[model samples]
Target chain A: MIRSIFIKETQLLLKDKGTYFWLFVLPILFIVMFSSIFGNAGTTTYTIRYFDADGTKESRQFMDTLAQIKGFELAADNEKSLADQIQAVRDGKQTSLLVIPQGYSQRLLGKGAAEVELHRDAAEDAAAAPVAAVLDSVTKQYQEHKLRVALKGTGQSQTGIDALLTAPIQVKDIKENVAKANPVTQIVPGYTVMFVFFIMITMIHNFLRDRDSGMVSRLKGTPLKAHQYLIGMWLPNMMVVLVQSTVLLTFGFIVYGLHLGDLFAVAAVIISLSICATGIGLMLSVLVNSVNTGVAIVQIIAMGGAIVGGLWFPYELLPKAVQWIGLFTPQYWAQRGMQDVMIRGAHLDGVWMTILILLAFGLAGLAVATASFNRFAAKAKN
Target chain B: MKHVLEVADVVKRYGSKTALDQVDVHVKEGSCFGLLGPNGAGKSTLMKLMTGILQADSGMIRAFGMDTRHQMSEIRQRVGYVPQEITLYEKLSAVQNLKFFGEMYGVNGAELKQRIAHVLEQVGLSDRANEAVETYSGGMKRRINLAAALLHQPQLIILDEPTVGIDPQSRNHIFEMIRGLKKEGLTLVYSTHYMEEVEALCDDIAIIDHGSVIAQGSLHEILEQHADQAVYVESDYITEPPQLSSIKRASARGRGWVLESEQPLHTLRDLSQLFAEAGARVHALELVKPSLDRVFLKLTGTALRD
Candidate 1:
């Protein structure tokens, strides 16, 4: 009986083109669009155009220092006129333009202040701000070097000058327990979990349609038990969700190069999430009175859960209250579990808690849904 | 004859509304028992209870000599039900629907396949067995619905208004199918508001109203007990109502007089004599036996469909 019902339900689902689109096409579209927009996270490099009118050693040394800074690729195109560089900046092709004055090195050596001109596009302020800050710090270091050289000339010892120039305390930055947070990891699993809920809408629709059409009463009239009928109703939906998740995850891996650590752990998370989603579908199927009401409720659940549970973006970026509320959604836990595996390279040991929580959600949903289904069957029969 | 189903003082209620009130019924084995009632007359409720889909509020229902509550699985295996509405997977083919329902009743493998083939042939939809039910016509769908019920080959078949919303030819085909089942000695409990269907197919009947069985007996017995014996006479001279002493009630019916009496033979003889004395020849004088519709009207004081 279970096999028969499952096959029938699966055939029905395959026949529904709308469900096919939502299950497969929508998730891939979300992944591809978001990946293209936010693909270059840590790999992005900003170009800085520099021109040196002063060919002195000091200016040459400053240019060398600027070239070694992280995430800034220096372009000292002396052949191109400074006017052309400025035009590039104005046209938004260049992020910023730097120019050294004619007497810069001589002024610095002779204890006279010198100024350098930096031109940037206002619209590129976000990218130009960091370049400007780096330039300021490099200039300050050069001034400090000049001061040290002046002090040495005044007969101060090298050690004393070095100690004075360096601060009494040294600070170092150490990153702790941080994973590689990138757009691919975030959006792939984010949309995967988000689209998993869409399967609930299909499940609820099939359930309500069968009930309203009197098929439920007919099935109950047979010798099949209630649990058998429940399994028959639930298993096919669960399988559809599992297939949807697997396909989306595979698409993410192939297209976006999504890194999944411990495939078994990821599979466990997806299985639990599918069960939870199927449970929600079951509960909603009986709770609502009509197909229109069921569709409305499912929409609220899928779209609302996606927004609140950080499927589109990280919940940590939201307000503390919203983040706390996100903890209440199954999507939050499922997305968190996927992030652990894909971003943190977590193993099975790491995601067991998330699996258990999702399982609890699924079990609770099944309990309430089963009770409601039984009540519905009884009422229908009467 | 052995009793296939028995209901004694069964009462079923839905909140404040009583759907079945002190309903008692007995279905003899190998006989077609027609449950006659108007809409909401407890026919469906009683059918559900007998099929073990529903439980009575305060009474016992036994089918196949077993309690419905305790032996539901056994009873379900022995009874087939065709609901008033189409209960099928519209997207699935007739054969697929039959196969699935057959599996639910523990029929599978070669047996299930053979049953599906047999039922599709029985319903005369063998050519359209692979077509989706949604693509089939209403009569074809109804045939598939009946085929689904017969998949398990249950001893008793309970149909709730099975022939509703179908063409006359299809209705007659359903009657032929029911007759075929009856020839096989399958006990049938058919409920419908169509009196002609009951009159054509049923051997025994129960007429219910307001959740109570107002009349029940063999077809002939119920007709004899409640139906009026009237002699309809048509004569050229009888333009107005006839005044006959032997007739208890005489009323003019279009170009004729319908005369009711305790002695129908004597009333007919007196009508013929009166027509001869009036210098008018009687063109037609025939005894009109009461139909089930008239019997239902006499018992329920309303039309069968009302």
Candidate 2:
């Protein structure tokens, strides 16, 4: 009977175009959209629109030096006056504007400071901060050069000058998971985990349809047991979620070159997540009285879990409290497990906690569904 | 004859409303037992109880000599229930729906396939078995709905308002199917509000109203016991009802008046003489047969359709 119901439900799902849209198509669309938007975050160039009022040799040299830095593209605004560019900044038309004032050469030659005016919108601080940091770095380099030249005039050796130039404290930067820390890694798994919960909606719909249409009552008259029916209805959805996740993850891999670290570990997470999602689906299918209520609850679970569980972004980036709460959601564990394997190069042993937590959640949901099965069946319209 | 089903004083209540109050019905083996009642008269409740879809508040329902409360699993294997609603999955093909139901009843493999084919042929939908039910007409869908229950070849088949909203051709097809099942010595419990349906198909019947069984017996016995005897007369000469001493009650029927009496023959004679004395032509005059409609009106004082 379970096999029969599974086959019937599978056929029904195949014929339903809405299941495809919600499970496969919509998740892939989200993955593609987010990947396209943020895939090249590391290489994205921040532009510095500037009016070189001084246009002198020194000002041009300064501008060229700043332009030499990577990820800081310089665009000379020769068409607009300095005042107009500053007004554009004030009016929020531009994030920031740079102006090379007159006497810029004299200040560098003299003992005075060579200053550049940077007019920026404070509201656009994130966009303007990198540009300011670039300018400050260039200023420090000039200062070091001045000091080196002065030491040369005092007849110090080159080795002594080099020793003096070294800073007392140095910051060393080390990149970890360099190959796996890309946007595709975040987005592919994030959307996949988020949409896995959407199977709840399909489950709710199928179960409620049976109840309201008198199918449940009719089936109750059969020799099929209640537990048999519940398991039969549940297994097909679990299989669907498995297939749905596989299709979505495969799309991520083929289209965006998403790295899946360990195939076995990924499979384990997929299996556990499928069980977890469909188990909750079974519980909600019997627990809710109406399809509208079930759908509303599904939205809260899928979308809300997506946000808090860090399926929409990196878990570390969320607020501390939300991160604490996200630990309670199976989606969080699933996403974390995927990232641990795909991003950190972990294997089955590393993701065991995730697998266990997900399985526990799935089992809990199944238990609840089992306990409520009789009441749910009783409510069916005879 | 052996009793296939026996319901003893079943009382079912939905909150404060009594859907079935001390309802009792019994079905003999190899018989078509009709549960006749108006809408909301608890025919469905009784049917559900017999199938174990519902538990009676206070009663003992034994099917095939097994208590429903304990031996439901065994009974379910022998009894097929066709719910009042068309409950087949519309998105699936007729063959697919039948296969699902067949397997649910523990029929499988080659046996399920063959049974599906048999039921499809029985319902006259063998050619359209592969098409989705949603694409079929209402009557065709109903045929498939009934076909689903027959997949298991149960000894007793319970049909709840199965012919409702069906075309005449499909209804005839269903009637033929019921008659065929009865020929095979299978017991059937058919519930409906249509008087003619009961009169045409049922050998034994129980008339229920307001959740109580008012009459139960063979077709002849119930009519002889509760149905009124009367004479229907139509005459152009007699403008008002003919005043006769033997006629007890006069009520308008189609184009005539049904005059009730202790002796329908005497009333008919008196009516004929009165019309003759008026020097008027008599269009029709005959003894009224005892009908389920008159029986219901006599028992409950409310029309069946009401």
DockQ of each: 0.69, 0.92
- Angstrom error of the Cα, residue A196, model 2: value is 0.7
* Highest DockQ against the true fold, candidate: 2
Q: Which pairs in model 1 have colliding backbones?
A: none
Local accuracy of candidate 2 as per-residue lDDT tens digits, A36-64: 89988978999989888787999999989
- TM-score between model 1 and native: 0.87
Task: Compose the digit string of candidate 1's lDDT tens values, residues B230-274.
Answer: 888887776766777767777676777778777889888887777
Stretches off by above 4 angstroms in model 1 are: A44-128, A141-180, B234-239, B250-257, B277-284
Q: What digit string (tens of lDDT, one per residue) describes model 2 on residues B1-306?
A: 899999998999999999999888889999999999999999998999999889999989999999999999999999998888999899999999999999898898998999899998899999998999999988898888999889888999999999999999899999999999999999999999999999889999999999999999999999999877999888787666778888889999877899889988898788777777878788999998889999999989999999
Model 2 residue-pair collision total: 0
lDDT for model 1 comes to 0.86
Q: How much does candidate 2 score in TM-score?
A: 0.98
> Each model's C-alpha lDDT?
0.86, 0.92
Clashing pairs in 2: none
User: At residue B157, what lDDT does model 2 achieve?
Assistant: 96
